[model samples]
Target: MMTTQGGLQPTSNEANMCTNDNGSQLGTRIVDEIMAGKNVFFDLPDKLTGEIWTLKFHCIGAQPGKEIVTVNIDKAYVAFYNVVYIKSKLGYSGRDFLFYKKRCGIDRSRLLALDYIHQEEAMLSDNMDERKISFVLTKDPPSDLEVSITPIKRPRQRTNVDEETIEVSIDAYKEWLAILQHDNPETDLMDDFREDTIKTYKEWLRHQGDLPDILLYERMKNKPEDVDIVEWHYMVLYFGSEKFQKISSRNSENRQKQRTKHIMGYRTFSQISFQQRDPETGIEPTDLSLWMITHCKNDEWSEEASRGIYENAAEKIAEKIYQTEKFYLTREEENAIFQTTFKETTGCKANRLHGHGYLSRYPTRSQVMESKFLEQARATVATNQKNIELESQVQLLNEKLACEVAERERILQEKMQALQEEEEKKDKCLEKK
Candidate 1:
């Protein structure tokens, strides 16, 4: 395989063969070798098709221009190949590959550096004489070229001949959490263990309310196979706790209070903001405009309940912008103005109204409509206050329930003790008779 500007280009000889033959095994081995700082050279046959490919990492050192460029380009090449191989195994292609790369910590900067190194190597190879160009092989290679390739391990299949154990790091735990929580369907690439763990957690959550304390405690104690015991304990304890329940309930309520929801699925706020750029000015939409555009239906504010509040906030923002002689505000200034306007209009912080708070900074309209908007805003504030009070009451009830449960357990223990004493007294009477 030759490295090209676009990416790895397969030679004519290897064109017919699939890159994913025994990919899991090869990827695992490559990752292990790279982490261990060992030179990897292997000729392995594709498990499915019996096509053979040579995987070698050459640590080449050359003085390109004024600087000494020491890099294992072959290592990067192999790692890149493994990334492709893993992606193929997971059925990820096109734009989804970019997400996978980011998830694996392979950023554009690293890729650019790799490409630059490759370019330098090409220039040196072409300019210098074949005999004079010293090919110095070193055991220690540049750490930058080492990409962290997480091979997707399949269930019921051995990763290696020795069945070497793969340790799940804290980073993996975070990645799993992100993958599970992310709303995108494309991000649902989880190995068997991760999938199982998530399913287990969901099942536990579903029954958390109905299950007794003893049953719930037992479920927490019963750790899944191949799961990190410590992490499992933490996950069960934290997520099952009353504190997390309260937070989740509050977030759900906040989401319910939102007047406008965007139809743009899987696209992030940054992506939407970038896409909302003006064609002529090339300037991105203001935070308020962006929020309004996303939330609006048919390019018009649709929700009658909150429409007045949005219109009033927008007018206030425009007034502030017009007051400035420069007729321009820095992004920070714009954001601050939006937040202040929202607070002044809504009688609550932007964060309190909008769950994430970013959308709360901007309103969509240009003109202030009616005093009725202020009335609506006041009503909204009152509703939010009531919700808070209700949440507090719920928390108190939960605490009271917990105390009652504990008291019941103590009473049950006392009753059991009394029964044991009565049994002992009956046995003494029988012996005396």
Candidate 2:
């Protein structure tokens, strides 16, 4: 169906109706390529699907508790699919999707707080079924719109595959490229991302001083300026840091210029990224860029607001998979995702509170544990000391009582002896008289 800015773009789905033979082809592509972990994302052509919806996938690895891969639609597209596609089709049941914003969790709060979604168009269809939580998207819609995955091909062709390069998660690679692009706006695509991002990542690796043989092989080229997209993607994700951008190998005035550019790029990424400015007008980082940038913001005000988007990303990636993927997570695993997000979001804020409060005195994680342990130990020692002092005082009181008793007994004996003498004197005097 066609969708407009304020209303659904109603489009006819007559051209791409699936024939009996080709009905499962589109579904098979989704299962084989996206869910199978061969590709992170691909653009779905409207021609193949008869324009039912514009589709893209951000595939995430099956999380620890999850057993199968999950497919997530971009948040912007959720509404149209909910209201126009599913709701409009009378043949389908109301028990289909869980309204993303309505989902329960810390992330739900975060997504609700986004400035982008408050717009009129962002509102989800109110008529959706509240009861059905888990449903699968079929390869063939009743509209007969066939679906297919556009396979992701690397920009550069490598005849010989280098097994040394570390295999990275697709979501992580996308994140790496996004951060790289935000830092360097001069390049629009990850395949084209170069200069500062690659250099900083390489310098970061050199600073670590234990560059893996695979990463080292790329940097050890005959020239100092060679760039590999895959190699740089891996290095930046695992090891890249602003602090380590100036390693020993990069110790010169020219190197300083590169660092200056890198710093400027980071500063630019943090400031204007939230604006969501178009690349033509200013800059647009990747979809994931917003979440990554928001997490990195330091200022308290911007930080909280940015964290909303950050948690939103986590929810979208992990929880959104439940709605669209074939291999469903158990109810327990679903709850686990919610709890994990709640902790990541709330736990970070708790850390900040500790930093600002007196608890800042306890810095590191182990140090915090040690400090708490020490406090408990000190409390135990103090209680033991108080017990010892009380026992000593009780012993001293007993000794004093014993001494007083002895003194009293001695006085009584002496008095009795004196009385006896007096009595004897009186008797002698009487006898004498």
Candidate 3:
């Protein structure tokens, strides 16, 4: 529709019908009619059924969320093929568009529908959607004329591909990633994914007194890094379709090691010389492994000392794994190995809380079993004594060898001097002759 900003008063659409397929006069709104006594009319071009038509209007000082003037024009007049343009009479802001017929007009029932359209021209306004449009009429009625036209493209044919193939559930992926990321705030992410995380997890599991699932839950919740991807794959593939379940050790080398370590404080039963048998059938092997005993001593153990103990234990467990011991352990189990295994293996300053009797399978069984503390102390003293005596013998041998070499040098020098004297005597005899 044609819009004028200054001078001249234009008549209503009834007085001046827009005969030209091209709109000859300014557009109309009911609010405009009441306020400015101007008429707005909708005109369709002749011989145009499928032809695309566009509606253009001018808005004056219209805010975004606020409603501009509304008018009841023929719904048919409102009909056109494609685009709508809105012009502002205040100043030449730019190009603008009105609400599409397919959106707000036809979809009042739909919850997700566009309520209004923004005029592209108004975008130039500092506030854009915040400003309104103002228009003036012409004294001659037809100040300017123009027809808004828009081209329409035909829709393409549909294909039969499945919806699932085209769409991915980002929500589900986000949840999975969240689970993977959940971890101890204090623990570094790099360490969690590293090999050490799994070791720490295993140790936690061994010492934890909670139910298997509960234990797993707490461990995973506290330290997500401890969960190895390989372990997850193994659990899912071999165990069938399940979340997580405790596996029995009867058929598992790992469980056996766990049991051996539990009772004897070593991951390798070979070192401890212990065996687990089936509890159901007296002679057969049992499915369950025995739980190892662990104690926390407050008086003798500070955090620093315990840390060293834990680290040494971890290193020792790493050593065993490096040696290709025929067993597997969870990360936490390995950590437990560091603590329990190191104590039993090293038998150093940190001994068990209560002096327990040694098992028959213990390597130092007879010696340890006979007089636990006294025997260990004597063995340590004897070892030190032997080391000192061997060093003294070596020193004495070195000194004796040095003295023998000096004596041999002295005798050789005397022999040489005697030979020189004989030579000098022969020379004297020659001179006399």
Clashes of 1: 1
**Residue 372 displacement (Å), model 2:** 4.3
RMSD per candidate (Å) reads: 34.1, 28.4, 26.9
Cα lDDT of model 1 by residue, 212-294, tens digit:
45556787678897765557777787877889999999999988876555655677666777787755344567657765765
| Candidate 3, 1-433: lDDT as tens digits | 3444421223354324322212323334322332332323223434334422223233323333222223333222332211122222322222322222121121121111112334322322321221222222212222223223222334686776664455546354334334445754453322336475554444444444324555445444443456544465455454432332344433465544331122234444333223443232222111111112222233333334334454566567667677766655543355446546545644555343211223223235675365445545666777788889999999999899999999889999999999999999999999999
What root-mean-square deviation over C-alphas does model 2 reach?
28.4
How high is the lDDT of residue 400 in model 3?
94
Q: Name the top lDDT candidate.
A: 1
Q: Is candidate 1 or candidate 2 better by lDDT?
A: 1
The 10 consecutive residues of candidate 2 with the worst lDDT sum are 106-115
Off by over 4 Å in 2: 1-351, 354-372
Cα lDDT tens digits for candidate 2, 1-433 = 3434533322344123212213234333333333233332223333332222222221112123222213233333233333223221212223322122323222221112112334325333321333211222322323322222233234786655655677756455456657766898875444445775565555444544645554545544432345544455556544444445555346565454421121124344435453764533233443344435434545342445345545554565565676766746533354345444534544433323211112223247997577557656766877798899999999999999999999999999999999999999999999998
User: Considering TM-score, which of the candidate structures 2 and 3 is the better prediction for this target?
Assistant: 2
lDDT score for residue 427 of model 1: 100
Candidates in descending TM-score order: 1, 2, 3
Q: Candidate 1: where are CA atoms >4 Å away?
A: 1-234, 253-267, 278-282, 300-302, 316-337, 350-433
Which has the better TM-score: candidate 1, or candidate 2?
1
lDDT of 1 at 73: 24
**Best-fitting candidate, measured by TM-score?**
1
